[model samples]
Target: MTNAAVDDAMLAMREIFPETPLQLNEHLSRRFGADIWLKREDLSPVRSYKIRGAFNFLRKAIATAGSGRVFVCASAGNHAQGFAFVCRHFEVHGVVFMPVTTPQQKIDKTRMFGGEFITIRLVGDIFDQCYAAARTYVEETGGMLVPPFDHADIIEGQATVAAEIAAQLPEGVTPDLVIMPVGGGGLSSGMTGYLGPRLGDDAFLMVEPQGAPSLKQSLIAGHAVTLAKVDNFVDGAAVARIGELNFAALSRFPESQVMAVPENAICVTITEMLNIEGVVLEPAGALSLTALASLDPAAVRGKTVVAVVSGGNFDFERLPDVKERAMRFAGLKKYFILRLAQRPGALRDFLNLLGDEDDIARFEYLKKSARNFGSILIGIETARPENFAALLQRFETAGLGYEDITDNEILANLII
Candidate 1:
């Protein structure tokens, strides 16, 4: 179906839930000197726009397939929760297949949302395997498999976010740019499908995690190309490949319109929003806004822009890692391999060089080299980012040999 039809379908969705807020964010606006507004999909009942797609897909399918028919889906995160929520809403029998390694909190939340209407099955170690198993079950049981994305119905449902954005804007206040995070690309595809023709060209920007730029890579190659490996740090947006249907919707745009937000930099945005603004955003949810920091501020200044915050299903257990990434990105922390003389006063002398704001966060002796020197692993955290520069000067003056390993992903995977 055409995007116009999707827009019509989405308009009828208001009978279930009101349009999510489209609030102008003063803090972000002042920071970027732009008329910045946030399309708060996080305010949905399921705390994500995923539910909109799930409900739309299920409601339409059941109308044709009839009640008592089983619906199945495989998702390790937001999609599973969305599917479960809609299953309960429809009072339909649903089976949710999730990766065995899925977090207990997420599993619990999905179960809670589904209540007695759904059953959970933990299968496979990662999402791919889980998806395979879910499809197998769907075939054997004659159940309908509800795809997380890459479906016409799901895309149509997600397009509602764009419809809401258009309706919520003040009269004559069309956004000059719309930024969205790309995961499996359901939301981006839906938004682009509905708004693409209406806005003509160059009206929106797509943001992807640095670790997973499936859409960007595919667009560059002029076809869909799956990554050999995907970094799951931003689990919400980390997909090996953009969905076929999603890529079709996005393919018309130039590759330059798609921006990749660095994984570490995204952590800085997430932590800042959480601590400073008291807003909790998952890594993917922060993707679109984080890209703003890398853009030409002049281009966005005085222009109305809408950034879709996709989801906020962050687990607090990963908070430390998030903070560590944020600190490193902000330059307030550094990890170094230091060569020190194996003498009693050697450690004391190095400690003396530290500024008041600098504190030793980690110190470990890795190996002994002869009787005169030792290899030390040191992590220093400072109150200000520039303090690290001064600390490096001190090391240089003292002729202390050190290698900064803060941003070394290889070494960090082993030690940090």
Candidate 2:
């Protein structure tokens, strides 16, 4: 909670790796009309800020519980990798429990980091089930459980980022605003706890995935609230409930400061950063940067802003899905369920309605709803979003009956 503790954590972190860079980003600066600096935590050895908390937790644990104690953690993403890295660094035994559904890339990365020091167990179909199993194991074995973000030690460790930021900023230059992504709230709480007093509470903005607005809903309810359903598209940041300790640190902030960004919209940012800026960002990592595009230009114009680029643990296999979501969010792609007469020329007529720039991405025949008509699912992609309007106008003139299912979650999930 104190600056001295965070400073000590920051100093101790050098034994692991030097500070990640704080670099001025020209593309973001010009686009937002603000002087933007990216605190590139994605560049860390573990490819995230998770290592800071994991290291701090183990350091203090070994000092109090002795080096022989076994450390255990449950995670499917960055935290597991960080815990594994620290375990290998300290030459201590560790047990990592990950969901069975976790990608093999993440599991392999964690194994590589811990080497012989860590034992990984793929348990349960989801994180909650895996976490429950971990708790039972810890109870039976008396192994120390390293929570991803709820504990005081974890918060103190994440606070090191703020310490580094304070030292890394140009002398006599204060940031006008700091943008951070919020999941279980460890990083956001730690950063705000350390810098809130120095920069004033109003200087911070917290972003969350729209599918998992735990912090925003909690703040609105005046207490921590758990979401009943969560979309796991942004796996790294789709926390159903905000951590109790983390919420306490962030509760004072107004609800207005917490922005919930759509998962598809975040993919747009991910693709843009990768294609335009040569910066690959995971869905959660792109949250802060994605929120920048939605902010009022006047609010950040000519001001010094800092956006935390959280992590880059992206799987190349998901790139196609990311691109699809991005295109949908940008309105460059659409899916329609069209009705056509059951005749040979019907297909030609429907094809004629599409503009020159519109390209067919998918064409599926569902079934004949009537003897004279057939239901067809069609997906179209175009270079410009405006092309869809003209194509739809042509369809109306041609008397083609169609229903846009691009935004219909239920139908899209079941069919598309």
Candidate 3:
């Protein structure tokens, strides 16, 4: 896409909402020793950069197909809200197909954005099924399908974000590094296409959730590949397959430019941003920011860097899970199975083994393993990670037969 096209899209976007902020984050700058600017796409009307693509797609479609054309799209959350908002903006009718498993908060927000302009259909249990249903509906009704990322107009629309960043920076200034989260590759591809020629391909870093390394895996294989399974914890960036057009735009970059962050690590960033900066970020939205922790300090120090805060469509109900994941990632929390003597003072003995800073988060007694031993599940949270090592040493000294199940996914899922 040309600068002119992106500029035009940006100009039109003003009719819906003014530009989101491009703020220099002092906390991050102090920590990384870099001039870290945040592209606050989280503050968008739909709480994501998804609105830009949806708006551009709808506007161009209406221009060509005329005002009353019906628009259809398939999305789990962010894109659905974006499509709904744009439909309401243009006073056009839209149909949003969402997975049956989508959060009610997202469903309600999408409905609120669309108001009378859109109708929502909950189909299937996953995004792929919902998307297929949307395609079938569009074919039957002969309506325009506003894809989330895979189309030219959508990419051009998302390119406007890069345009805003270019204009928002200090006069005669350019970012030395641009880090962005990747889902279907819409925002990252658009930004890369717009900035690569001027800033060089080496300047961009694309982050994806470790559980769903669609772009990273695709880059490794020199083509898009579908993931066998994806963890939906980072729902916003957990795409199974990168879009074809988006991958084509991103294919020029080296595979190393793409970073896959652990899902639990993202939770740590989310909690930190919320508590430290009073910023709310969903799991996927925290991907880019979380990558900073893994970057070489030398690479970012004294550099002008921009990390796109992609979205803030977080549900408060997930805070506990987020906190738990964060603690686990930080090594401040752990789960274990202990074989205790099924006699008086057995519980007291285990309690005495815990360090002063160690607190019991969960304790469950399972069936008796033998006449004198009982299986017990224990969860402990400590002030510092080092305390766990000391506590485990004490357990060994006491001759306590304990199994650390913290990293055992299957066992933890089944028992803890």
Candidate 4:
């Protein structure tokens, strides 16, 4: 509620890691005609600001409640690492629950962060089930449940980011706008709480993965809303529901302050930052940066804007997949299901129909047993999106039937 407490939290954090840098990003400033700065939370000890809140919550609890308790939490992403890392820092025992499908990279990272201070349990195949198991474990063992977000202490810890940002900005240059990314609303809630009262008429914007519009939906509905399903591609920000405390903190703002970024669009931003700026960003981390591209230039010109780069915990192994998603989102790639005549030259004819700039990325035959016709699943990459129109016309002229599944979510999930 006050800068004094937030200041204390920031000072406490110095024992673990230095302040994440707030650097002026020349590339974005030139692109948008604004004085753009990036608050690089990505460079934090755990590659995220999650540790700030996670550590603060445990620190206060242990200081007041004594150190003889087992800390427990359920997470498969950044929060898990933050909890594990803090458990080691405080010399306390912690239990982490994650879904069985969580990547080995994450599991290994959590283990490495906690060392021998934490025990990890893989349960169920989804988050809800895993969360339930964690709750039951806490009930049975009377262990302390460290929520990912939503608690007063956690919000206070996350607010340390804003506290640091205020000091890290260039001297005498007040930020006109601060763009933040929302997951369970921890960061956004903390951000607005610490900075909103100070930014008299200036702007604050929040970005969330479109597939998980919990914050936007809740604001529209005038209450916290839970989504039936969520896409976990942006694993760090794909929360099904905004936390009660988080939503309460954010509820004062109007709906227009939040933006929903498509998952593919976030991937494209990730690729651009990595390729052009040599900065790696996780999908959630790219959310705030990508929102800048959608804003009207008139609103940003001559303004000092700060965008939070939330995390950089990207796995190098996912680079190829990320590049493919980026290309598809940019309209440079597409997929189709082609019904080709079951003739020897049919495949050759289809191949010849492709334009000079189009290259076959994938070709697989389904339903080969069909005597008259075969189903061909094809992936094509092109230099231009318009090239597809010409190629499709060629297919029609040859009496071939095809269905485009380029933007089809259901089909893309099942096959692509």
Which 10-residue window of candidate 3 scores lowest in summed lDDT? 60-69
Query: Which regions of candidate 1 are displaced past 4 Å?
Result: none
TM-scores of the candidates in the order shown: 0.98, 0.99, 0.98, 0.95
Over 93-184, each residue of candidate 2 has an lDDT whose tens digit, in order, gives 99999999999999999999999999999999999999999999999999999999999999999999889999999999899999999999
Per-residue lDDT tens digits for candidate 1, residues 1-416, read 57667767777677667789999999999998889999998888778899988988998998887877899999989999999998998899899999999999999999999999999999999999999999999999999999988998998889889888888899989888999999888998889878877786698899999889999999999999999888899998899999999898889889999999899999999999998888889999999889887799889888888899988888889999999999999999899999999877999999999999999999999978667889999999999998888999999999998999988889988987
Per-residue lDDT of model 3, residues 1-416, tens digit only: 88899999999999999999999999999999989999999999888999999999988888888987789999988999999999999999999999999888899999999999999999999888999999999899999899988998999999898999999999988999999999998898899999988999999999999999999999999999999999888999889999999999999888899999998999999999999999999888899999988899999999999999999999999999899989999999999889999888988988999988999999998888888899999899999999999999999999999899998989977987
Worst-scoring 10-residue span by lDDT in model 1: 1-10
Model 2, residue 329: C-alpha shift (Å): 0.3
lDDT, candidate 4, 346-377, per-residue tens? 78887889888999999888876477988889
What alpha-carbon RMSD in Å does predicted model 3 have with respect to the real structure? 0.9
**RMSD in Å for candidate 2, one decimal?**
0.9
Off by over 4 Å in 4: 368-372, 396-399
Against the true structure, candidate 3 has what lDDT?
0.93
Whole-model lDDT values for every prediction: 0.90, 0.95, 0.93, 0.92
- After aligning candidate 3 to the native by TM-score, how far in Å is the CA of 341 from where it should be? 1.1
Q: Highest lDDT among the candidates is held by which one?
A: 2
Alpha-carbon deviation at 410 in model 4, angstroms = 2.2
